[model samples]
Target: MNVTIVGGGVAGTLTANYLATRLRDEVRRKEIEITLISDRDKLLYEPGLLYLIFNRLEEKDILRDLKILLDPGVKFVFKRADKIDLENREIRLGDEKLSYDYLVIATGSRIVPEEIPGLTKTGHWFYNLDGAVRLRDEIAKFKGGKIVVSVMGVPHKCPVAPIEVTFLLHDFLKIHGIRKSSEIIYTYPINRVFLMESVSELVQNLFTEKGIETRTFFNPIEVDAEKREVLTLEGERERFDLLISIPPHKGSKVIIDSGISDDGWVPTDRYTLKVKGHDNAFAIGDTTDLPVSKAGSVAHFQAEVVAENISAEIKGLPPTARYFGKAMCFIETSFNEATYIWFDYETQPKFVKPNKFTHWMKIAYNRMFWLTARGVL
Candidate 1:
């Protein structure tokens, strides 16, 4: 049997590595073949981008070669998948076609700053490597002024990132002796500061203590770069010297072009992690339209379920694993302190008090993330 996985992010990489361990016997017998397809040759630790923007971590510290991370039993294919023919169980790669008995779609999301007019030209973000590098330069040159951190859309990867960046910016400016001259403003689309009420309350209190201003129900429709203003759907014009935005995000174009999902997100079974209507195919990570944070932890937890189920089927065992919307994240309140939260489908988030210990843990995880990609953690 041939198994094909598309995408090289945390979900795809971990799933490939986990399957290698589970199906080692079958692989040695030459009865099962595992192939992972990715467009890029390097796998990036995305959470490190937050530190990258702050110059706390360098580019080389957050990237690893894809071939080195994958298990030897898994074949790595460097190619961009053009379309997935679900009916024929084939993946189209430019002029070539690859067939698979079982398919895993781990295609992740992408940031679309162009979706908001003028944002591409004037705004800054840290969602991708290039954006992080550019933002780092901008942050370095900034002296003092009104800085705005806006959440333009929801379901973006790393839900707490906006809050974390706001806190870090405040600390950064304070360390640079510009806190007294700078004003920090945070904006969110909903009436509350965050989707989780508990988290919102905690963050709101922290923002208040840090003297950071917040605007609720603020949905940015367009950015007037010339006027240095952000026009909102609520008819508010917010001024800023520097605009750091969490731009709108969308799933892979390949998923959309293949008619898998209208908006690129694949319809997935939240429990089994299977693509809806296709038993032989599965979806995980940011590619799924699940009501959960599009964070790495979510992808890591889901990867286990996908790998286990697929391996079980090949080994003639019942696949009983199920994902329960498990996710965990570390929110940095300052350079030396952080807080942590974990929640599932039936649980509400309760963040721990910010402390130095948790901050160290977050730092330690940054280096250990490579082990995670190799499924050694």
Candidate 2:
């Protein structure tokens, strides 16, 4: 049996490692083959990008070669998947096709700054390596002005990142002796600062304490780069000397091109982690249409379920694993303090007060994330 996995992000990498370990005997006997396809050669520690913008972590600390991270039992292919032909159970890469007995789609999400008018030119973001490096330079040169941190759309990866960056920016400005002159305006599309009521309440109180300004029900329709203004759907024009935006996000284009989903997100069974209507195929991480946070932790949790179920089926056992929408995120409240929240589908999110201990724990995880990706933690 040939098990093929697409993408090389957290979900793909962890699932591959878990399956390799679980099916080691099959792999050694050449009864089963595992392959992972990725366009990039390096595995980026995505969560560290937030710290990268603040110059807290360098590029070297967050990137690892894919060869070192993958298990010896799994084969790695460095190529861009052009299309996923679900009908034929094959993935098309340029001129070649790779067939699979079972497939896992973990293609992940991408930021579409071009989706918003003038956003690519007028705004800065920290969602990717290039954006983070550019934003790091922008933040370093900032002397203090009105900075707008706006959430342009929902269902974006790392739902708490905008808030985290706002908190971190406040401390960054203060440390630079410019907090008094700078104004931090945070905007979200909904009436609340966050989707979760509990998290919103906690974040609102924190924002008030820190003197950060917030604008709710704010959705940007266009950015006037020449005028340095954000035109919103609500008919309000918000001016900013520096614009920091969380642009819109979408799932892999290969999935969309394959007619799997209109928006690139694969229709997936929330519990079984299977691609809807296909028992032999599964979807995880940011590529799935599940309502969980598109954070790496969610991908990590889902990988366990996918790996187990696939391994059981290959072993001719009953595949009974299910995912319960478990997700966790660490919210950095300041340069030295942070808090975290964890929840499953049935539970409401609850967070403790930010403290130095939790802050260090987050820092430790940032460095230890490689182990998690390798399924070692």
Error of 2 at 320 (Å): 1.3
The TM-score obtained by model 1 is: 0.99
How many steric clashes between backbone atoms does each model show? 0, 0
lDDT of 2: 0.95
Encode model 1's per-residue lDDT on 272-348: one tens digit a residue.
Answer: 98889899999999999999999999999999999999999998899999999999999999999999999999999
Candidate 1, 166: how far from true, in Å?
0.5
Which 10-residue span in candidate 1 carries the lowest summed lDDT? Answer: 344-353
Model 1 regions lying over 4 Å from their true place: none
Once model 2 is optimally superposed onto the true structure by TM-score, how far is the C-alpha of residue 267 displaced, in angstroms?
0.3
TM-score against native, each model:
0.99, 0.99
Determine which window of 10 residues in candidate 2 has minimal summed lDDT: 366-375
